[model samples]
Target chain A: MNVFVIGIGLIGGSMVKDLRSLYDDIKIFGLDVNKAHAEKALSLGLIDAQTDYDELKKADVVIVSIPVDVQLEVLPKVLDHIDDDTVVMDVGSTKLKVCNVVKDHPKRRNFLATHPIAGTEFSGPEAAINGLFKGKTNIICEVEKTAFKLQEKALKIFADLGMRIRYMDPVAHDKHIAYVSHLSHISSFMLGKTVIEKEKNERDIFDMAGSGFESTVRLAKSSPAMWTPIFKQNKENVIETLEEYIMNLEHFKQLMIDDNFEKIFEEMQDTNHIKEILNGIIVNA
Target chain B: MNVFVIGIGLIGGSMVKDLRSLYDDIKIFGLDVNKAHAEKALSLGLIDAQTDYDELKKADVVIVSIPVDVQLEVLPKVLDHIDDDTVVMDVGSTKLKVCNVVKDHPKRRNFLATHPIAGTEFSGPEAAINGLFKGKTNIICEVEKTAFKLQEKALKIFADLGMRIRYMDPVAHDKHIAYVSHLSHISSFMLGKTVIEKEKNERDIFDMAGSGFESTVRLAKSSPAMWTPIFKQNKENVIETLEEYIMNLEHFKQLMIDDNFEKIFEEMQDTNHIKEILNGIIVNA
Candidate 1:
């Protein structure tokens, strides 16, 4: 009944909260490269104790909750240190590289590749709060590769956390994620950059930024340390999605330049279907 | 005192809520080209009464809250009907065109061109709520042209609504708003379009759209009826900003294709400053 969470940031710390709430007998341990985050998680009562690499062997379950590049670095090590009965899982943004990194490991059957699609723009342990995963989707890739017993344990945990699980191939998961998630970060980050570069008046930006600007640029606040590797690992799919996204912007911009207000209106009216689609995405409190 | 609110959409109806709370013995009249919206405003108590074109003359002050295209069509007429003592202010997204259209009118001094940087993605009377402008910025343009006495009354109204006012020239207002407001809608509308075109699985879009995608594309839900005229009125500025935005995206895409991870990371890190900037923009509850 022991769970050791590696790199305890927003996702890891939030997961630890839900796990403890679900199982009274479970003891949770956390390890973070960020000493400040580790201390904060402890002060926030997010973990039972701070464990190290040496004590990582004592856990029945190990969750790799770090950036993708770091996950590629430490996941094999975690699998090597754990016992045969231990269940190892990772919640990384990009899955293809991580899945391939451990594809030939002897203990790969005990490993699970998952991405729980939830988080705010903020990062680190202080950003963690209860119910981050509630009613969110958890994408499990190559679930068939995992041992049946360990998969059952992970599924039970997600169910207890109030999540709906969707199974997909690792490649498909990364591609769709590039379109739905990574492109948004890039679009948002660049939007912030373009406006910042032109609008020299900082006070004016602050004064005139409506909720729409706030929402559009919110992801620009995401952690650079976390995102750099994600963009690197999923480079091809990310590039393809970026091209399509840029082309769409260019097309819309051309319409604006042509003073084709009617066409622009029609295109935007077509895109308004996202309202109906997003309603299913956002669960109200 | 009397205040006549034309259009009766999100901005107009929300303003009515605040005016009632901030003023005593002030009668508010609502008008809309759409009968259903006018009726909805009345039922929601957003307006004291549904006013007609004939009744617009009885106002001591008038708020011409409508779409920009309609503002161009009807603003002069509203000015023609109001007395010299009445202050006719507009809450349109664009300023230059509206300011230009009425520049030579005999009652020009009676009209004040203002753009309040406030609103949610949803529109119409039902979308109206209390305190939409509280702690938000209100941009008053061409103040020199507005009568000194009338400017005093308008300033008092903005202050009573818990807004901090910033004044700029009409041309400057449209240019800055093109970058800070209208450009955001274009970015968001296209982002939604790009992602929607790629992911045919509506259920997948529903499941995969995290708060990041939701935040980035939130403006896609905005009413086309309202935004069409905004782009048309601010055509040159919107086109300029849109071109810059598209170029930024193209540059980012090239870096991604070149696998220039370091440059991409640095760019995102720089834009991360927006997080700090946005804190000043959003007023927390």
Candidate 2:
């Protein structure tokens, strides 16, 4: 099996790491626009060799793991080169734009739109780790649009990688992801900004920040080059989540101003149900 | 050494858990307004026995780990009962109010104001775990106000527990804590609220939420009984941090509306410095 992984960053590099250990006959190729990242991934033993789009035609499977904005330009070209039996899948965070970009393509049936909800705050090829997708949810957007044979091939790969699959429409995937993923990054980034603006003494933040603050602000360390495009692609839904989040913060502040400790206490008590919800995630994950 | 844990909850329970392992001569006592919690702590071996305020006169060290509002009411009474040699320390998140309330007390020299920057989302005696304070920061406020001998006793305990100590004025501690601690809770709770409100289907959150969302919203599961008092006690500083946080969110939203991806990218890029800052915390932690 000839497999090509485009954009050899955390996601793509990690996928190949798992794939190499899972299969013996497979030859994994890394295709990155950044030559340094490709070399780094190769040196890290994340791939068999480095290749580009010209050789994509030989790929039995092409995994598109670039930033969402870049996927808009690159995915269609990827589909243009693959064989009729070849399967192409994208692991972008936002799904609607990419799904729409290839909705009317000649080989539309060969492509799968997926988002494997797994990653750390760090980025780049060096950040990749084995088993990143294991026990993590991989949302498949518009899976029915892909050819049955191609779908089966992708599903086998995901199964081998230990990913739980959930299917949803592209629009709903984008909206739901805005709430679960995109909004988290924004809230975290803004929280970091607010703290940095106030605590000019970085030493104070280091000394004073507890585990709660560390966990909450961890996402602020994500790569902007990757996230800016996700926020752009899912602008409407991201803005909606942001507005609701801002309003919620404002309402809590008002409760504080009114000296409504009773109400403030009630609000936190109500949100405590997230504990039970997150427990299920941990078990499933 | 006789030690009395006045709250027998996560913090107090945890303190005794470590203290018990470190000192063979120490006999730990639990005192709680809730009889069940005191009994639970006794059953869990978090305390050697259950005791009350009348028994406080015998305590060599009284660790107050209750809500800040309750501390305002119960702390002075605690000081009145302790011996001149006994050290009464309150581990509430807020410091200024508690410090002022005991400022003129007859046994003020026996009181120590400290906030140990450690804990999980869970609360109560069962939530207590050994080594919870290991390598964590303990902020001691108004140390100069305490007697030198009592300070040595408290600092020794902190050091023995593997906690790094830092001294600060109560006013400055409250203000700095608002940004790093209080504001993170508000942001996390509000993020959980925003998502819970939008995703009426709880399963959506359970399935769609990734590690980032989980970490960002983890504090939403914290005990309101504990946090409400902390926010109320540090009202002015918490409010100031909230206003700045809300402003930053509003600004980010406007940038989204204006399609200013450049500025959004730059904003996150600038905040990426939090990575280095947080690395220091992880190292020191």
Candidate 3:
């Protein structure tokens, strides 16, 4: 099988790594707008060879793993160049915009929109892991729109990589993900900004940061190039999540101002149920 | 040497776990306002026996690891019972208030104000782990106010547990800690509250939450009984940090409203420096 992975960064590179170990006959090709990243992917053995759009015609699978904004511009071109039977899939964070963009495309049936809920604070090809998707949920958006055979092919690959799949409409995926994923990155980044601004002496933060601070601010290190586009495409939903988040923060502050620690204790006690909910998740790091 | 642990919870229990392994002749006793916790600690071998304040005079060292509010009430009383040579140390999150509470006490010279910057989300005797303080920072405040021999006694224990000692004034310790430690807890708890309120269908959150959400919200699982008092005692600094955090969130929300994704990108890029700074410290999960 011929696998063409475009924009070979963390997600794309990780998929190909899993594919290489899963199948001996598979030949993987990678492409990146950044020449350095593609070269790094090549030297890192993440891909068999670097290829161009023209070679996509022979590809059995084309994985679009770039920033969501770029996915808008590049995905259609990728569809135009791929073979009739080629199964194209995108691993972008936001699904609604990408799904809407290819809704009426000539080869819409060949494209499968998937959001694999997995990642670390690092990025680029070097950040790829061997089993990045193992036991992680992969939300498949508008699966019925894709060709049945292509869905089967992708499902087989996901199964082989030990991924669990859930089907959802692109709109719901974006809305719910705004709460679970997008909002987390924003909250983390903002927390980092607030602390960095307050602690002029970096030594203080270094000396005082505990596991709680490290865990809470971990996502602040995420790639801006990747997350900025996600927030842009899912603006409405992201804004809603942020508004509610800001309101909760403001309300909590008011409770502090009112010296209503009894209420504060109850609020945190209620939220502590999150522990049980989170127990179901398998965090990579 | 006889060591008395005033509250046999995560911090005090873990300390005795280390002390038990670090010395053969030292006898450890524990007391808790909650009878069951002291019994559980004794059963778990975190303490050699359960004892009350009547045994404090026999205490060569007294470690107070209760909530900050409770510490204000109990620390002076604990001082009243301990011998002049008995070095009393606290592992509370907020230092200034605790320091002030015992500032003019007759046994002030025997007390060492210390905040061990280490913990997991879980609490209670069961949450105690051996080597919990290994390579973590332990902030010692008002060190000069502590008798030199008492400081040596506390410092020896810290060294034996492989903890790095940092001397900070109580004012600076509380202020700096509000930004790095207390603020992270608020951000995380509010993040959990926001997501829980939005995703009424908890299944959606369970399915969608990735490593990012899990990391950012991990602290939300912390015991409310432990945190509410810390916030109450450190109200001013905690409120200041919250104001700055809320302002940053509002500013980021404005950036999203204006479609100023470029600025959003830059903001995250600058905050990415946290990763480098965090590398200097060890976080035991």
- Candidate lDDT values, in order: 0.89, 0.94, 0.92
lDDT per residue for candidate 3 within B1-285, as digits (tens), equals 899998999999999999999999989999998998988998899998988888899999999999888889899999999888899999999888888989899999999999999999999999999999998999999899999999999999999999999999988888899999999999999999999998888888889998899999999999999999999988999999999999999999999999999999999999999888788654421
Give the lDDT ranking, best first: 2, 3, 1
What ranges in model 3 sit over 4 Å off?
A: A283-285, B282-285
Model 1 TM: 0.97
TM-score of chain A, every prediction, order shown: 0.97, 0.99, 0.98
Q: TM-score ranking from best to worst?
A: 2, 3, 1
lDDT minimum window of 10 residues, candidate 2 chain A:
A47-56
Output the lDDT of residue B278, model 1.
90
Give lDDT tens digits, candidate 1, residues A122-230: 8898888889999888999999999999999889888999899889898999999998899899889988998899888888898888888888989999998999999
Please report the candidate that would top lDDT against the real structure. 2
lDDT of 2 by residue, A1-285 (tens): 999999999899899999999999999998899999989988999988998788988999999999999999999999998899999999999999999999999989999999999999989999999999999989999988999999999999999999999999999999999999999999999999999988899999999998999999999999999999999999999999999999999999999999999999999999998888899899888
Give the TM-score of each candidate: 0.97, 0.99, 0.98
What is model 2's DockQ versus the real complex? 0.91
- Could you give candidate 1's per-residue lDDT for residues B144-262 as a string of tens digits? 99999999999999989988888888888888888888888988898899889999888778877788899899999999989998888888898899889888988887887788989
lDDT over C-alpha atoms for residue A256 of model 3: 96
Candidate 2 chain B — worst ten consecutive residues by lDDT sum? B76-85
How much DockQ does model 1 earn? 0.77
Clashing pairs in 2: none
Tell me the spans in candidate 1 whose CA falls farther than 4 Å from its real position.
A283-285, B283-285
